[model samples]
Target: MQKSDYFIKGILESDEKVVAKIYNLFFPKVLSFVYRNNGQREDAEDVFQKALLQISARIKLRKLEVINTSFEAYLFTACKNLWRRELNKKQKRVTNDEVKELVSEESDMAYALLDQERWELFRDKLEQLSDNCKEVLNLFLKKVSYDQIVKKLGYTSETVARQRVFKCKAKLIEMIKADKRFRNLK
Candidate 1:
């Protein structure tokens, strides 16, 4: 098996030694990311812990499978995403001056994290949709044109593909709105 597979197995099994190694290997990078994004050391620690918990939960649900990315990249992305959500929450209460300061110093990482959070939420809600809806929405998200979607999904016409995409998008919005976690995140 690959080294990343070992990391995945260790995380799934809660192997102390492997977990410790992962923390030692990846925590610095996560910590640095949080620190650079207006977070303190304690905040970085919290983010790291939360990322680990998310990974554990996904593993338990059989939702985390190592595909294109390494385990390290996955863990780091989780940390960035959690930190970005925290930053969004913090931004709501900050004054205009504070907001300006943050914006002035904003890194590409911050923007990427924001986009990542959005995509993650969309994917989470997409899973709640019907198989047909999932297919249509996924294609739409991938920037497939209406005519292409019609051909690919065997829809009657471009108009049908457009309608399916619109309906699926509406359903996804409804699912997101109904989620308690979505409210909490906002």
Candidate 2:
């Protein structure tokens, strides 16, 4: 059968293979989208994976029902909602029409924080890094492979890029720990 059919089957039956197929099909776009939106490649990849897990759970629990919408839309919306929830929890911003409109779902707000809160906090810190650091980390997190990173980033050598990634990540972790909003997670 075709790949599309395979993915549809996976969604319909909650089959692992189908889930994997769906991941291959749409995760790239979602990851790129997330990274472009102040998320790192790792953050995007992680969010996409967790979104799939959530989708599987919702399907199993009958909490998510997809009728006419494209699977890609459903998956993206779910991931986006999940990310917003993590942001709100970390930001702890008061509810307002403008803020509410900025988010897509409200139910996740009621659930207890999982590992997601910490990850989102980390993502926030990633944005605080210098532009070069953020770019390097984002590319590295996307699994560009060391050689590819050197090539794409215009680095003279893989070692330089690697060092930057290390320094940036270290600084990000330190900043997150120092920040009152995220210190509790450490």
Best by lDDT: 1
Q: Give candidate 1 misplaced runs (Cα > 4 Å).
A: 95-186
On residues 1-186, what C-alpha lDDT tens digit does candidate 1 reach at each position? Answer: 998889888888889999999989999999899888888999999888877776676666646565346788878888888788778867665734454434332353344444554556766788878999998887888898888898899999998888888888888999888876577456
Residue pairs of candidate 2 with colliding backbone atoms: none
For model 2, how does the per-residue alpha-carbon lDDT over 1-186 read when each residue is reduced to its tens digit? 644344555866778777777778888888777776677778777777677666555455544333234677656766776666555654655544345434434344324233444555666688889998888889878887988888888988989888878988898878888888675554
lDDT of 2: 0.67
CA lDDT scores, all candidates in order: 0.77, 0.67
Candidate 2 displacement at residue 129 in angstroms: 1.0
